[model samples]
Target: MRNPSLAPPINRGLILRDFPKAEDTPTVQDTNENDTNWVALMVRVRDQRDKTAFAALFTHFAPRIKGFLINSGADAPLAEECAQDVMTTLWHKAAQFDPARASVATWIFTIARNRRIDMLRRQRRPEPDDLTWGPAPEPDQADVLALQQETASLSVAMAALPAPQRDLIEKAYFKDLSQSEIAKITGLPLGTIKSRLRLALDRLRHAMK
Candidate 1:
């Protein structure tokens, strides 16, 4: 459904040139920080409202998100505006970023993707007095029941995981923590966290079967 014609030329050099040099950005190797050290910047923004950290995030993600929006049908200017709005939302909602649930890139892109979709929908919305509306369809009871059953099954599977794995899964799915946040909370290496999560999910899939 995306309008690829609106996409701009994706030049990594152009995008990276606008951000701080790689040496200036925090890295896992330079410090004892985990692979998701970039998320620590987000946490700093959340706890201290650190403008420097926010600027770093904006510098890194804003251009990428603009490209994403443009690829999704927005004009280049509109994409730039939406990207700024997305960064503004990140600034205001920093406390809500959860590392256990998603990586920083995934979380930011999800926001961008959803915002772009919403903008598109609003642009296409009918006028209040437009008479083309009809009653909405009723909910499907059978489908609802099936979804409920799946939820129950998933709960049981989650309960069967090791406590640590269960805790991560709960934070990711229920509390909506990002992977970096989970790493911070659990003091686990990012690789270890990912491996454990993979193992846990494998068990969950088998349980579902």
Candidate 2:
């Protein structure tokens, strides 16, 4: 493994830009210094159980994981909690990181993905057996095409929305908050929140067609 001290400083901007960049970004050799190989850092963590290496890894990934969870519909507090859990798991399971199979970012984000799913499932109340969901139906060609088209249109429409509407939509869907919750968070009336959502959905639907 390469010495951390000799590695180039890790670019925090690149690390946050995309997880794939983690595989390509250099790691910091010193916990106090900012340059090193990520793969090497993981190896150090695995072979020596190096706390510095683990700290370096945490510094790089924790906030990104939290943002990812938040973007995937988790609340801020839940995202923070899940991100911490993911980092702790990475520290303990560093030996399992396989550079050949995936980059360090991919591996870490996989853990984040799984953790988010588990958190969401836990948040959902258990339903009676009779109300339990069954296997989902496979999408047919037309349905698949229509869904794809709608997704593309919605993307465009969302980008075109005024800042206020866009922010509301993000809070409602991206943050997975209800209208009431969004109203409370934004200090808007419930009626105003509902009206904005309706307008946004209308524009999105029009764009989809």
Each prediction's RMSD to truth = 20.7, 18.5
lDDT of 1 by residue, 26-144 (tens): 44133223224556677678779999989988888899888877766689989999999999998887765544334466568667766876787765323245112221122233432
Looking at model 2, which ten-residue stretch has the lowest summed lDDT? 13-22
lDDT tens readout by residue for model 2, 103-199: 4665787788778767987653343363122211221334323332333333333444456666766666445677666654343222322443354
Q: lDDT value for candidate 1? A: 0.56
Model 1: which residue pairs collide? 98-177, 98-178, 99-177, 99-178, 99-179, 99-181, 100-177, 100-178, 100-179, 101-177
Candidate 1: segments with Cα more than 4 A from true spot:
1-35, 123-209
